[model samples]
Target: MAHCKTSLAAFIFSSSTDQWLAAPSKDLSGLALDKHDLEEMSVAQHYIPKRHYAYGCFYWDWVQFGIKKLLLLDTTNMEFSTADLPPGEWSKQGIAIVEAGEGRLGMFGFHSETSSDLSYTVARNKGESPSQWQMEKTMSLDSGYKYCIRDATQRYFLFTRVEASTSLENRLVVGYFSMDIKTLQLQRVYEKQYYSQYQSYTYINFPPSLLSSRRI
Candidate 1:
């Protein structure tokens, strides 16, 4: 873990860790994926949401939860909630999310390896699932850098990195998908002109636009 001059901290681990931690900063704006020892940091409230179950019912049981309250100085009127998964509540083997259509909260999760298991969920507010969590119409990458999903101007983007075999290869995968915001239908918008295997691609987004595409 290293903290920059801006006090923004970044944690990098082994190769395996790099594969999973390729997600960008914006996706982590109001949320944290809580693990046992280490977790993502929030520049705002130092808020951390963990997966915990009380009694038979689960409370705050989310693999990753969004930050509902962002009180700068005063932590009063604190609102807390959890984003629920789909109706069947399929455990997200791999998950990613971004802001939905500007203000709504939208997320996509990969269930095992089956395209039929791929699902999407949107929330009006924090921690609240829409009436239904729908399965994506398309399939996700089978392997490589885990797919990170984001929305831009009513279109969804999927990012991943393809690694080259030798030392001379550049480390970036040049592929992106554009999708409809409502139905989760996707079409390939950007693709690699030349086949150069990349180590990994990191995804980050601005409120309304994609900020950077980095190969690290």
Candidate 2:
């Protein structure tokens, strides 16, 4: 990624050379990019840290001059590109990039600050023409408690539920849950017995051997 005030550039770490090498630039003639559009482009500021990997590509959320775009890093060719965010009112609060089945990119987010419904949209024909977003599904969460999206990856997103409190500092996280993007299933991964402030959650992958039981 490029540093502040520098021309946009991407580099890949070479395991063989043990050094960072410039990534090969791909022909972006098909995209709507121009020199002016990229003049102030950067990945450092207003960048969403939650990265989603799908179909040999990594996706991130980037906001340039109040316009939101998805920064795409194609690992297959070690190239970088950008895509426009899906149309409509999308809040940055809980937005997440996820892998839609059949080698497609999908995004999940709430419609509004007070809405209890979470919407999922998938990008169709990405990189061919201006990508089209199709609404796949909408799931409603429990309206009794307030919820916050903490992190997301693959086909799952981690969220926290807290009792509504007027003061941010006084808010207490009541539970942590994981929502399956495909099935829209909500599963409680953890419940807090004592009061605590909101915190980040991470997904951990355990080997099959550790998850399975074997007779000694």
**Clashing residue pairs in candidate 1 (N, C-alpha, C atoms within 3 angstroms):** 82-127, 83-127, 162-198, 163-198, 164-197, 172-198
**Top candidate when judged by lDDT against the true structure:** 2
Task: Give the per-residue lDDT digits (tens) of candidate 2, residues 75-128.
Answer: 777766778878876654567777777767777787666666788888886541
- Every candidate's lDDT: 0.38, 0.65
Mark the regions of model 1 whose C-alpha exceeds 4 Å error after superposition.
1-78, 87-106, 113-117, 121-146, 150-157, 161-171, 193-216
Displacement of residue 165 (Cα, Å) in model 1 is: 9.2
Q: Kindly report which residue stretches of model 2 are placed more than 4 angstroms away from their true locations once superposed.
A: 1-3, 8-48, 63-66, 126-130, 193-198, 207-216
Q: What is the lDDT, from 0 to 100, of the residue 193 in candidate 1?
A: 38
TM-score of each: 0.36, 0.74
- Model 1 TM-score is 0.36
- In terms of lDDT, model 1 sits at 0.38
- lDDT of candidate 1 over 77-158, digit per residue (tens): 2222234455443332334454455344555555442233345656545423333444434454545443433233324445
